[model samples]
Target chain A: MTDSAVMVEAKGLRKVFKGRRGDHTVAVDDLTLTCRAGEVFGLLGPNGAGKTTSLRMLSTVYRPTEGVATIDGHDVTSDPESVRKSIGFLSGNTGLYPRLTAREVLTYFGRLYGMDDGAIEARIAHLAQLLDMDFLEKRCDKMSTGMKQKVNIARTVIHDPAVLVLDEPTAGLDVLAARTIVDFVKDCRTRGKCVIFSTHIMHEVERLCDRLAVIHKGRMQFDGTLEQMRATHGHDLEDAFISVLEAA
Target chain B: MNARRVMVIAKKEFKDVLRDRRTLIFMVLLPLLVMPVMFLGIAKFAQEQQSKKQSRTLRVAVDSNVEPMITALADQWMAENSPRLMITSAKIGLSFPAAGGDRKGLGTMIEQVRDMMDGGADAASLADLDPDLVESGVRLAREIDPADKALFDDASTISTFRTKTEFILIEDLEPSETRLPAGVEVPDDLPESWDGEQLARAIQDKTIHAAIHLPSNVFDMLEDQRASVPFSVFYDESVSLSEEASDRLAAFARIVGNGLLEMRLADNGLAPQFAEPIVFEGADMATPSRRVQAFLGGLLPYMIIMFSFFGAFYPSLDLTAGEKERFTMETLLLAPVSRMELAAGKFVVVFVAAVVAAVLATTSLGLTFTQGILPQGVAAGFDIQFEPEAVMLTAVLLIPVSALFAAVLLGVALLARSFKEAQSYTAPLQFIVILPAMAAMLPDLEAELHLAWIPFLNVSMLMRELLKGNYLWDFFGITMLSMGLLTLLTIWGASLIFRRETVILRT
Candidate 1:
């Protein structure tokens, strides 16, 4: 934490969702964290563990309940448009219009980010080549899940933003597609982009993440590196995760 | 906010809408083909039914007392008319006594008459009249005027004796009413020399087609001067062939009247021209073209306005609820363009589709009237001409109408949670549009200055008057301003909806 240059910083971040009958559900309890440029930050949690809510707040899709979050020096609450411009977001269930071809889809997003025609075309072609999405020139509705996943990945990076927030990005992908996504995350980190990825798969954390936070029942239970976690709770990452949850 | 980004969004929306088979079918193919097919099918069916009705011969039962007179009338009518009229004599039952019946029996008879007039009796099983009963009143009328060779000259004498006479005439009657027996009612004020028109109208209220009245001097008139007697024939108007039958009977009466006049004039050593001093020349102001144009004027605007609703329907749903259902809306929201730009881009697609549909519908209606579907005489009479400039102006007017419709529909559809829900939301919109769109159909509704500023009604009325070759510039200006303001209002409303996160995220 001391060595890493902060790319994302939050102080006392909280989120409350209003429910039916005038009740409120605390989705994220008072939590604070930081992720640095050129490092992978993992928000490891079980289902409904407030991971997606926090990610949404960071992406500026939702505002923080009590405090503030800043992405690349832009406040999430006041400068949401700027924060949105700085980040590329993807979720496993984030959908693409089935009617458009992969290239058209990417070009659409690139232009929305105010990219000129030449840049958009160039970006689409480059991403299509890299992600092997050229085959997705056919209708998207006819594409296999892995093919759709690749197209989704290409769409996310088309704007070349400084930060990437992925929510369970590999939740349903086959092995080959999952590997491609993991590799893309590593490549994003290498490009000096701040990457915060949320996942429940422990192997994903063990392989790619540099620092990790474990949250449960809307509260943070652990916050440290994989080695620090191993040093405190034994070598097995899965067992340590389970131990942390059990203790909490 | 960038133009390039907006254009990109527009292009993508177009692709998405076109790729959807249902949207494509609804927006383009259905309207393009369905209207012509529906119109032509209805027209063909109507023509076939008319031809069938004209060619078929109807069998009408007549009372035996008036059998000879009716046969003569029918013969003369059939000879003069194109469609053949066939008459069959059958005895209709009369429960009334030969002279004066008991009061209770008369009441029962009147009740039976009422039932028969109310369309209760079967036509096939009607009772035959007694031959002696049939000729009793006719014989009585003849017996009163033996010596006076000029009894027909005394009009009051016939009126006096008609109260006592039971003789009747039935002509050109509906089969449904042929089951009723005659001579049941002699309402005291009924004129002895009445024609059938007033009687026919009265009987029509009770479902009776025709009844006959015979004056006492009818036989005298026939014998002494060979003159036509004054008699009445009554019939109902709502019977299927009543109009044709009424026309036939009127023609027969006119011929008989002319013949009687001619006979009397000849006997008095005068000419028929002396009786009719003046000739009437009828002039009709409407040309064939004007008639056709009037009908087209009413129809064209309605069709154009209706197409606007249909054209807006699918794209509105597709852009909003359809995208939401497919899970692509979040992706769209994540794009760097502002919400307003996305809304505007979608609005453009729907607006274009609506305008195109409207134009096509108007063109089809115009072609239907001009392309030989209507008779040349009718087309010529109507002078059904629309200038190219007027059409262009109407097209310009449609832009605002289309815009207003598209924006309103898009806003409403965005609030819906699914395609079916959006359809439910927009279905009543057609009802909202239809009445105002049909302004031209009501010719009595004049296009007032204030009405010129009403939303859909103004466009409808203005288009109608414009197509009729009228250019009401003040009305036109008001319509343009009104439509423009309404369009802006709707677009603004749609923008507000776009800004509502709750509406956009409604699941």
Candidate 2:
């Protein structure tokens, strides 16, 4: 991916959440980043490190506390609906209605995204095939967690959004199920979709992300390619992550 | 912005709500089943109480001198008024001995009689106080003691005595002690002063339904021409049934008084008609429907309005605060549909629930009146029939009322962080609606233009008037217009709340 193909830009993106104890906690501070088309960008952080908060801002689920974010040249805050229409969001805890079947959940979301009935059905079939979800025909509650996650992913992309924001998308899956998500993200990146994923797993970041940022305590500690990060810090990415945290 | 998106959200919400077993039971099944069971239970309870009260017998203790007079009067009264009243008396021992009787023996006999009446003395001791001694003691006690004048002047003593007597009547008497054969409850205390204003006040206070004061010389008064006897009755205005019973007793008294007068005149060989020249006829103009409407009008509206709050309660909580708690609100907000569309979609569900509950409650009430849930002859004179068109119009009026309820509840519920918090906030709303809704049941409230604009009160009045087959177009129009305007305002307010992301995602 070239610089000219960058589809998402976050410049000095900051989010300071006000705590109930009359103190301000910096969720994301002075963070600047960019993601090119056809590139998978992974944000690595421990819990409460502003990864999800930043992703939420990028997806227009939340307005940034400060700074600017744009998706496909549309400002997240000012043109939120347009940005929302352009991005598909998925998260581990994000759920499908347990009462609605996989098809029904997809169709409902498809309609919400303003897709026609024929288009919604076609997209459901296509995504179901891509995710290997043909066996799941009942309500989400009756399905395995992995099956439900597949349905979740299908619902997220049913509208064929140009950008995808996934927060710990494979946080709870077994080996094969996690591989399915990793492979899906690679496919999305290959299809020229800009994907920003948040996860704590070093292997997922090593295996999938082309460019990455390591955020610790709401500040980006590292922003570079994998080889560049390894060469600068250490041979092992996991050890390098520990060294950065220790040095901070 | 698309209609399809709203429908999708609504359909998903419906499915989600229905799948929640607790909510499904509360929303749909509860209203369907609770009404019939509740009404039938209440009706059965009322019938049981009435039957129990009718079958109950009261016991009375009478002095011997008063016994002869009271017995004859009671017997005549009972004979004249059958099924409603029955009287039997127990001989009461007096506090003093009769003139020319053994003073010590009378005192001992009276003490024994008191103990026996209280179930403390042995049967052998009670058998020793002969009937003649007990009778003489009763007659002697009737003669007022001059020495007791000073004691009667002491207010504290009098009050204490009265209190003690009241306690004895309430606590010490056996269940069968006051057997009147029928269920006539003779008041524990009867007024002696006979002041008209006091009697009226007592009646207003529900102290005595009717007090029969036998003049000291009632027989002599009947024999002489210019002797006038006065009897006072006290009843509560709030107890309409008691007032009706009192009126019947007064009419019977008047008939007996006239009979006595005719007998006196006939003994002098003059015609009974000469004693009474005027006759009057009495008629009650209130129809059965009007009477039934008066009762049911107030209750129905209060119930409908109050129940509308409950109908909107869970959905409002689930759709707003519950969604926030479940962490699904953020996703919903991210949907392309505007906040107004989301609010409208949720408001539709809650409003439908409210309207259905209101319609069901009103329909159940109508069934109660029509299907003889009450005694056949209790409200028999009232002809209350709900016209389909009238009911439909009322339901139309309720649509706005329900919308207003749903919108207000949703807006308030959204302000809370959790379902429990929302419930705490919204529970008092029922009381707020119930009080004013019950105002239409007030007897003197005529359908006035100004009153028609009052929230809840107007609906109650119109429903009552409509049930009585009185269509006041001006009142109906004003009420509908007021309710509509209020509902629109509330909806606008709810929309405003819906737009606030802070409130929408409060948790």
Candidate 3:
């Protein structure tokens, strides 16, 4: 890691869900990880792997049942608003308002982030040009999924948050749509922004991540760099993921 | 909570909902058009139906023995000497003039009065003259056509002057030698005997409109009885033809009875007052508008409550459950906004929507009364402007009701996974409200101490009483407290649901 300030840190982050019939599920269990500024940290996991739960806690959307995760030193539970302000969160299920135009959606989010109208307008224009979007006034409902994804990306970074949490952002995307997300992650790293990207695509993890962690059953099975992951498990990340699950 | 942030959210919600055509239809167009058109159409339709029923042909099955008396009266009714058909209310002085016992002198005097009326003596100018004589003359002279003059002589005369009741004589002696009368048709499956029950069934089935059973001794009873005979008139009350047929038959009975009484008095040389006792006059003192107010008052409150609920329904679902279906909920939660602020924002939007709908409906009803939907005669006294106090209390009552609707709708809808699912959850709520809101319509239900605490019932009762110019202050006070407490509880519960991540994400 570079000698940059640590932007995201989780200390034994735990989430236990209570069922209606007096049962408990450990959605996240004592998971801990740290990321520095200017690094792309890849969280690799299959479905139902607590990848989303961990990201949710980090973004202050869900309160941790035990332990704590902090966004740039702001506690997710005790100082949730600050933690929320510090992180730009996106997930596969997150969607834009169908009735709103892209410009209106971006403006709404920017205002929620406490940006003045002028600043909101300025940020939207800047992001629109950078994302190479033309149909700012077009309603999101009628837009193609590729176009909607671009608007979603613009909304995620409207406040230019220091920490970004993207959970399977390219899960349903085709190759062309997936390329945009891969490039955006790279752009975040160049801007010295900390990004935690969770996906099951091993090739993507290999290509983009400077550091990586593998999780299964709400526990971290692996946390290290690309070299360390290969050396500890195997040369192939897919086989390595299976070995970690088998051990768990 | 940040007020400005809440307002921002509310403003956006308002803008979004205003674009929806469904909301506008419920909030504005329904009140503006549907109420007046439907109410007026119904009134006009009923009037037309009554007119049609009045002229319809009627058939009566009269026993052969009493048929002679009824036929004589029907003939007299058809003749120009149709006696004044006194409604039970009209008071007629019983004393006769000089030469009272002489029927020939009375006939000559009646002809003289008719001549005077034709010479342009109005009812007022001839007020000193006997009212009965003048009324008869006025009835004869006031018409352009002789047919119209004959109609002016009698009760429902448009039918009486024409072919009215077709009296078919049925001999009671033998069922073996009977061909069904063409006027009154019997059912083919009817028993061979003339059983009363079978005859009643035919009437009920409308196979025959009416069957008159004049007592077998009616001729002997009329000839020697000291008291009037009690004759049975059988006609089903449910059918329009039955009702109209019964009325005409009763009129025939009255004509025969009164003619007999007048002849008896002349023979005895006594005043006609001996035969008459007390008179019942049904003079309605209530203004037409007051009657309309009492009629519309009970109904108006329920409409206001129901319209308010419908108004809040879609907006609450669209903003909450609808957001989840669209998958934009997570994006909203991702902001630094508190759950309470989010609920508050949505509650305000839904509450305003409900008020807009209620106000529109109330205004439309008011206009319906004032703007010719009610006929000019009936609407003349119908001044139903709300007093400031009534308006103020009604508005206050709406606060809790709207709050309850907004919060409950949001909380319930939020549990749903999609807009259609949300509709299923909310649709049944209208039923839950209908029973209590309909309390105003329950005729004997009044605003009492125990009733004032019954949520929707309280508001409805109080609203009705207020419209009818009653201010039940204790009921109002207690109802407001009850509704306000319930509203607060609902809002608290809704915000709690909003705070629940499981509920929000539907995990």
Candidate 4:
């Protein structure tokens, strides 16, 4: 889509946490990955397989114990504020303020992003209509799981951020709600926006991922297209996913 | 450190906290109503119980022969003691008296009534008196000495005098028929001449709340030249009715005893003044307001400091650990705001809550005094004068105290993974201030150099001193400095914790 297209790059990212008893757990280790504008990148891993940890490092939510990542042209560590302004991040661990109405949640973030009231109001209107969020005035705590997910999705993109990093955003959503997120991810890619999504769902990886990375045990196991993974590892995508885990 | 961003964050927190019904209850309404209602309630309740106690009728019994004698004693005591008090000459002299219905101020009438009670005419010369001179009659009565009975001879005709102690003397019943109230017992062996045991049983059973026991042939024993009479008085100490009855009966004995001694002294040509050498005088100089302020000082500062701690408690938890619990903290951190800005925003909400609570408590107390809401006796003793400058200085001290509270609470609460865990951690914090805050409330704890450096104690003590109209400038400077240092250190520490991904993402 663009002559120069790389939007995110991670090189040798490492994160180690010291446990309460002084044991060390390496959450992410020496992982290298990249995603470009107009690309839907899938980070596939099981629970605690460094998928969320890597994404957190990329989003600047956590600092790398070693190495670095950059969003667009800004280094995440050196220019975190700019990096933050560029990326919309969502995960199972991130949620809406229940006491705040959906509209309030959006407006608050918009203000934090240095948006004027007029711009925030207009953007809220557009997102409300686009997301089918008729319950925007309802408090986040009052919403059903599906409705709450929609509010979360609206909050993630309220600033119209250029890069979207989603960590299992649809993990527990109903079918229709999951479809809304899937459509939104595809829509983000269609508008030449960069997307890095992590999930355990194989079907989701098959239907939406353009290029993928498999991380296991705090290390990247594979990084390539699904067809290339299938050719090298196994025929079935699920089998290839499991084989990669086993080999690791 | 964008002001607008910090302001935006602060405004948002205010909205969220204010909308929380529980927060508003502690922050706004409690401070507005508690003191006034509680003091007024206590005053009214105490007044009611007192009136009830004074008007109560107590059951009494005596040896059948003693009833008429006791009745005669009551009348004779009144007749002997109602002295002939002379009214001092005043400016407004009337020809014998004023018109039939001349109006006088209640103060003037009360003054005249007081003169009559002290040993003046039955009808006082109700001329305008210098209120100061009206009090001098007590001095005059003491100086004249009752030995000179002629000095108190009544000069003006007035209404009849009245005695203060009024009692309904029920007819005497037999020792057995005068049943004890409930839990009473008599000794098995009893003396025939002085059955003090039966009298004790009568009082214990509460059948007769009070009783006087006389010896058999007691009149003959008394009439004998050198013999003495032995008898006993019985009453339950715990029963007010019984206690009051004993007091009145004791008074009659005292009057009769004194009359005997005086008559003996006169027969020997001596004066009673030989035994009564000391003239006692008592003066109270404290105004009502100062008394109330001194009393309140020992208690209110503790409450205010405790409330300031509470004001920071929930909010700091809700914003830090609470965010982690709600899953919203990460979302907030992801926004392009610094941890300090976030911390500052949280700090503002809690500080406002603390200051608002303190101000409201002060306002409530001020209203309680100014509104005349206490019962008459209590109100008469109160004259609270709030110095505006002192209050303003006290407010300055609240700043660092509240800041330290917010920062320390937020920093500690952020370490927890949930609201309940945060609560346990913060609860012990309330205890940390307990010793120091209460130390300031101790009336004898003077503001010393060493105490000025102890953080919470210093603030509490400084606030207390400021409230009492003492500036303690050097102590104030040091306390503010120490508090400022503590606040900065706490804020820095909180910012450090805010920067920690381990704490922010504890769950």
Best by TM-score: 3
lDDT of 1 by residue, B1-507 (tens): 667667778888888898888877767777676666666667677777665544433222233345345434444433332111121111121122222433232233333333453564432212122222213222322333333314323423334223222112121122123433221222223333433565555455533334554554554566576565765655556765544444444554554455446555767899769988998989878776777677778888888888877887899899998887877776777666678888989998999889877777766656655576544433344336678877888888888989998999999999988888988998999998899999989989888999998889999999989888889999999999999988898899999998775577665
Cα lDDT, all candidates? 0.71, 0.69, 0.76, 0.73
Per prediction, fnat is 0.61, 0.46, 0.69, 0.85
RMSD of each: 12.1, 12.0, 9.1, 10.9
| Backbone clashes counted, model 3 | 2
lDDT string, candidate 3, B1-507, tens digits: 999889888988887788777878877787677778777777778777876665444455554454444333333332323333211101111111113333222223333444455677654444334334334433322321244354446623323321211100111111112221111212223333456887688778776677666665654676675757765678889887787767655654564566556656766897778877767889998776667767776888898899899889889989988898888898888988888888899899999999988888888988887877776644566675667888777888888898899999999999998888999999999999999999998868867789988999999999989877899999998999999999999989998999999889872
* DockQ agreement of candidate 3 with the native complex: 0.66
Q: What are the per-residue Cα lDDT tens digits for candidate 4 across B1-507?
A: 988889999999988888776667777777777787888889888887765543443455655555334333333322332211221111000001122423232213333345554555322342222222223333333333344334334412222112210000010111122221111112222233336687667667765666665666654564462565543567888876578667645543554455455555666798988657887888778676776777766666776777777767777888888889998899988999988888888888988888887778777777787788876678776667757887888778878877888889989999999989999999998888888988766889999978999988887887777777888999989998999998899899989998888888887
The lowest-lDDT stretch of 10 consecutive residues in candidate 4 chain B is B164-173
**What's the distance in Å from true for residue B423, model 3?**
2.5
Q: What is the alpha-carbon lDDT for the whole of candidate 3?
A: 0.76
Those runs of model 3 whose alpha carbons end farther than 4 Å from true positions after fitting are B58-197, B225-231, B270-272, B374-380
Q: Is candidate 1 or candidate 3 better by lDDT?
A: 3
User: Model 1: per-residue lDDT, tens digit, A1-248?
Assistant: 35756879988889987876889989998878998988899998888989988887888766788988999899988887788788888886478888888777877787788788899888888887888775757778889888888888888888888889999999878898899889999998888888998998999999999999998888888899999999987799999988888878
Model 4: residue B317 alpha-carbon error in angstroms = 1.7
RMSD in angstroms between candidate 2 and the native structure over all alpha carbons: 12.0
A best-first ranking of the candidates according to their lDDT comes to 3, 4, 1, 2
- Candidate 3 chain A, poorest ten consecutive residues by summed lDDT: A84-93
Higher-TM-score candidate of 2 and 4: 4
Per-residue lDDT for B1-507 in model 2, tens only?
567667778777877776777666556666655666676777678887765644443222222344345444544433332211110112111112222434232233223334454775433342243322222222222222233334334423334333322332222223242432122234334533557677666555656544445566665664466777654444554765455445544554554455456446756888867865776878879776766666776667677776676677788888888887766677677667778888888888888878777766666666655676655655365456667777777777788778989999999998899889988988888787887788767868888889988888888788777755678999999999998888899898989988765577667
